[model samples]
Target: MSEFDKKDVPEERIGLIDLMRTIKVVPLVTLHSPEEAVPLARALASGGVPIAEVTFRSAAALDGMRAIHDQVPEVTLVAGTVHTVDQARQAVEAGCKGVVSPAFSDAVVDWCMGSRIPVLPGTATPSDIEKAYDLGLRFTKFFPAEAYGGVKTLKALSGPFAEMSFLPTGGVGFGNAREYIDLPNVFAVGGSFPVPSKAQRQGDWKAVADACAQARQLVQG
Candidate 1:
């Protein structure tokens, strides 16, 4: 009955946990410098996919993630390729909305539970999916999507994992992103195609923005 803080409420719904679904596409970017973070994030935000899954594959990842969170406050940032508990801790500290791993990690999921952070544990097999379900997590990341049989595998899993939802990434590009993203079982899609590696390296914010705009049009059109 008393007043409660919104921060105290940890979102649980797949639809809510992964706000990327509303936008349809979530860019996975890894900028090398914090200075690039603001512009890159702004580009994506302004372009329409105002959401990004910034991964921890670089030394600048944490600070870059924080820079985006601070500068482009409207852009929802999620941490991706999280492989360690230390990385998970640092990610939340940097203001990431959720944690995504390339592979299932009980430790990472456990850390999220203890810290009250939304964690989209990755899955590739039935056992992996069931592990997430057993952890009371209905949402997950389907990594290496293309290499793992992509849509065919997702369809087959949908029979038993009917209630589950996925955020398929890895190999999800502009060409085939629509196929996986349009699925009823998929809440959203994540990939670096929207923010190309060369573009990021060259500080080409406009290119990133244009890609985001095109991705938005594809999802809407």
Candidate 2:
């Protein structure tokens, strides 16, 4: 049995979904080294955005999460690019408050469902959305948003899945972030654009902070 029973979990609490919506922008990050995690988190918070989805695309994910969780408790953290229950469990143990997958994985979703852990599975098509709906999930991540038609596609999805909400990632940037946030169906936007590769690699935390501040302004405005 899981640590938290599904039936015992209350619905009134301000959960991950609520936090994501409130933040309006979630930085999708992949840390190259654990040493960068605390500074990177500080940059995000200083820039006005205090949430990050640390991806498992790199081996530094767990350590990076630990660094931020231990040093920057103010920044909300979630695990991204998770592929299995083990990864999800590790992420939770490492201090991530939620889990996000690039693709819907049955095992991972099931584990989250049973454990009452919040998860935003990726849904790129009608079928994928239906699967998520059937699993009782109302919020999901629309991935590779640009390639799948971006705003146009999300507009269409709203017609049928009216109650469904999304955090559209991939190809999202400062150039068109306002367009996505304007949509009622979109709860928030996720991408690495706010943390530019050049800035992160060069340890130019101010640049990252500036980018985050700009993104927050786009969402609020």
Best by TM-score: 2
On a 0 to 100 scale, what is the lDDT of residue 168 in model 1?
A: 89
Model 1 regions more than 4 Å off: 1-18
Candidate 1 on 1-221: residue-level lDDT in tens?
A: 01221234355434345366678787888768778889999999878888888888878898998898888999888898899999998988898878899999989989887887888888988999999888777778998888888988998888999878888888898898888877878878888888888888888888989989998887665
Measured over all alpha carbons after superposition, the RMSD of each candidate to the real structure, in angstroms, is 4.4, 4.3
lDDT of 2 by residue, 79-182 (tens): 99999999999999999988999999999988888877888999999999999988777788999899999999999999999867899999999888899999
lDDT of candidates 1 onward, in order: 0.83, 0.90
TM-score of 1: 0.91
Q: Which residue pairs in candidate 2 have backbone atoms (N, alpha carbon, C) closer than 3 angstroms, thus clashing?
A: none
**Candidate 1: deviation at residue 140, Å?**
0.2
TM-score of each: 0.91, 0.94
